[model samples]
Target chain A: MSDRLAMEDRRSSRLPFPAELGALVAMALAGLLGYLVFPDDLAFLTRLIGIVFLVLSLDLVTGYCGIATLGQSAIFGVAAYAVGNACLAGLVDPVALLGVGMVAGAVMGLASGVLVAKFQGLPQLVLSIAVGQLVAAMANKLSSVTGGSDGLAGISPGPVLGIFNFDLYGRTGYVFSLVVLVIVFVILLRFVRSPFGLLCRAIKDDSLRARMIGARVYPRLILMYGISGAVAGIGGALTAINTGVVGLDSVSFERSAETLVMLVIGGAGTLWGALIGSVVFQIFEHYVSAANPFHWMTILGLMLIVVVLFAPRGLVPLAVSVVDRIAPRLGGKS
Target chain B: MAWTVLGVVLDAISYGMVLFIISIGLSIMMGLMRVVNLAHGAFAMIGGYLASYALKSLGVSYPLAIILAVIGAILISIPFEFLLYRRIYRKSDELTQILLTIGITFVIIGVANYALGPTSKSIPLPAALSGPFDLGFRMIPAHRLFVIACGLCTALLLWLLIDRTEFGVRMRAAVDNGDMAEALGIRTQLIFTAAFALAIGLAAFGGVVGAELLPIEPFYALRYMVTFLVVVSVGGAGSIAGALSASMLLGLADTTGKYLAPEYGEFFFYLAVILAVFLFPNGLLGRKH
Candidate 1:
């Protein structure tokens, strides 16, 4: 790494912790403190964790992998149905449901990857939209299984890991989600830092160059897409278990667009952005909706316009700039 | 069975005709400017609404409404092309284009949803256009025949304009090589403005022609824009013949699905689309520029 990176790393570690570690600690402590102080806030945190996982999944493919997709919500919707279906069948085992979701999601990802990896530009975007609409239609058509527009419910995930009981407040769900988020983040950190990750970024930067350099772009992209699907599936499954409800929102265009916005706001290609971006955007969404349900889209739309026009680099880039400015003032760097 | 099949086939053709109108312009834009306008549907909606107003307020015939709507769309799109699209014409990255279009789509959708209530409305088809025409095999809606006629005439007009006319030649030349066309004193700006206007006029005309089949509602344009643009993708962007072929194919597929099995219908069609795109990644008629 360059000296600037080293100094940034050192700066990240100044508080006797690595950056992600520090962030995780801060979150856990905040969660614990909120549990003690607010108590009711734990459920919200759990939902936030679930939302964060979604943002993370989006970041994995879109931000880090550089694959601009519009159909991830389809995979999320599929996983949700899987989880809810398994639950309705009395298989309330979270682990098994998550695994099933992951497998189904991975399969969809691979299928979509084949379609998308070879295509570029308008065709790809159109295909992605088609994927989302197709899934929505499937879910709508198989109303007998998916419960159609009414959505699936009556899911009582009695306990998580058979140790922590799912209480009235969903404390177990919250903590379980937090643990999963941390574990997934660690895996994703390792994955993105790997050679495959480098190749994906290279493909993103200059696909022609990556191809000329023998990157075997399609297979790598397929792998990345599969992982993204798996992550999205996990997020979906967790959402089903936590809320005890699964609906058409999983495969919605609005959800896909929201996740895209979250990935941008948080900082694409950075793991931390997923977590922070999801939390921040969800809160913003809740507030915007509360202000005016029908017109909130206008606000979110304006934000999207602003970000693309002015802050195309996203929140992470803004953060990096601020840190850069502060470093010299703190006598840390030139 | 034959009656329904014949009816559905006509319905499909009409649907395809509308998609052809909307996408031909989009395909042309993609060919000439290499810019994907996600807001093409908005222009279509504007046409539909304007036509509806003309029919309701002025008591104008459907054909007159369509003409007025097309004119309105042309006038509207020229300004948009000059202000927004002209700036982003040279950016090579699709992602940037995607973002710009998405932003424009959002703003338009918002404004439309705000201004136009969410309730769906339909343009009044005159008795002449609404009549059930007697085909030798079965009866078909007159409006359906009209849309098909409109599509055929537009295709012929476009071909002649591009291949036979000086303006069309200049437009095609500009599409192929913008710099060269500019250097040759082709007055590229006027050509671009005219192309933009013509492209949107087609969308508006389609909007009025096909308004009865698909009702105009808030954000209605944006909802089906992607599906329509798939024609441009399938047929070949900038290739008029390609747009026609793709629209007809997609229209037939959609009609067959809705007719045969409404429940499992859309599912089957999209599955085919996914498969088709996988096999032909650039689209059915895609050619490297």
Candidate 2:
């Protein structure tokens, strides 16, 4: 029965060498391609950071951990403001700013975890909105502490280790973000495969069953939620640090919803999917907006509708499925 | 001073009544379908737009335009219910419902933008509602007073429809337990469809009545989504009285909040929403499941 099931899984399943190997190769290749195409790829470094943070955190929460939170953007906004406030107050170091953002995110996540972990179903959804509203309200209220609707301006960072400067083309930003992403990816790859990661997945798949079998449910959820917040915060802080422009967009419900979409588009529960989703969405936004700004929203809206309807499993899963079929034709299946 | 206080209370109550009309339909759908529809506000917006268009563009009278807009909203909702929302019924995954409805909301936003530009459009009161109606000691806008009466009437009518009628009994049964209702020959799918249509219809009705307050705009739906969400959260899912009570409280607080602090009104609304959620997750009236 096991062998038969394995065969069935292989025939239908897309797992080739391993999930980590594929992600690593893809990230490296994508990074290399970015470098090849743009000599100043680092200028767009924030996009890479954004992708990593959005994808990794989303996969951790929605994919691996099975927490489908639409309010991930809330923490992202909070961290962005944290970095913005820090930078405004003369905290110029990128690495240090990152820490501040993560701490802010940790605090916010811990607060929300109380409400999130307690409930299921409608309660969860309602709580997420309430949390988002609270964060946004705080941001708006403290426009004095954090720039109000106008956002913080003239936020030019001093560069990596005080060496590189932020160019107009986004090259430094791209390279810096790529390095961070690679490092984070390596750490995540190891973490997810570890016992903790397995337990996280087990908890997500069936919380009640996991609890029945002695899995510490609440603590695990709280831990992951905080970690995910930290990751999301890092991304937000990176953006604020790199771009030096912090605004309410970070906390807007639209941003949160879009990040979830990006996670869904690339692949749920898979890091590479989040990365791919973020990159695709960013690139799509860049090009689509270039054509006509109004068309951009309508196009994305239509794309979301199509994606939800046809590829419910998201594009990453669909891609792997195709790869699985094609590989066997090229002597992939043994 | 006494008369002024009475006036504030009366205005606040009437405004709350309008909010109740808008929120209760949303409560039913969210309770029964388990879909936190981001598009409920859009249906109300649609009613506002259609009603405004009828009054302004077609030169229809205000009351007649309202009726036309309600009809228009219902017709639009039928197609929306069938094509868009039908697939998501009973789906345990909340993400799908949210994303799908968001997508629908975006499409509606785009359509509204194309049909009725990004700028807000207001519906002029019909001649009858243009002036104020004087009571023994005080006076109120004829339009607002009419809305209050209509809102209360709708609430009562909805009460009968949901609690008293056979359809209501079946719906209540289905909402409470879908599989059991299905086994009992209730046709839960039909109930879902009817319930969805009714939900949209109520939102439309609220839209036309409250047009003066919440104008038709593209991002209007997005802004008010949290407001309705607050109402649902505080009221609990599946209870009309809970929704009514919550909506009235919110309306009164909102009016007073605006009066007390114009700039901080929205900020306080959100703060209050978070506090409410902290206090009641299933809402104030929600039964323990």
Off by more than 4 A, model 1: A1-17, A29-45, A326-334, B136-138, B187-190
Docking class of 1: medium
Model 2 stretches with alpha carbons more than 4 Å out: A1-25, A36-45, A332-334, B1-11
lDDT of 2 by residue, A129-155 (tens): 768866776677677877788987667
For candidate 2 chain B, the 10 contiguous residues with the lowest summed lDDT are: B263-272
- Cα lDDT, model 2, residue A198: 75
lDDT of 1 at A265: 68
Q: Candidate 1, clashing residue pairs?
A: none
Residues B1-289, model 1: lDDT tens digits: 7777777888888888888988898888888878777778878888998898888988888678888998887777776676677776756456556666666676666666787778886797788877898787767778888889988999999999999998888988898888998998988878877777887888888777878776798777667767776777777778888788888888888888887888774776677677666666666776666
How far is B106's C-alpha from truth in model 2 (Å)?
1.0
TM-score on alpha carbons, each prediction: 0.91, 0.92
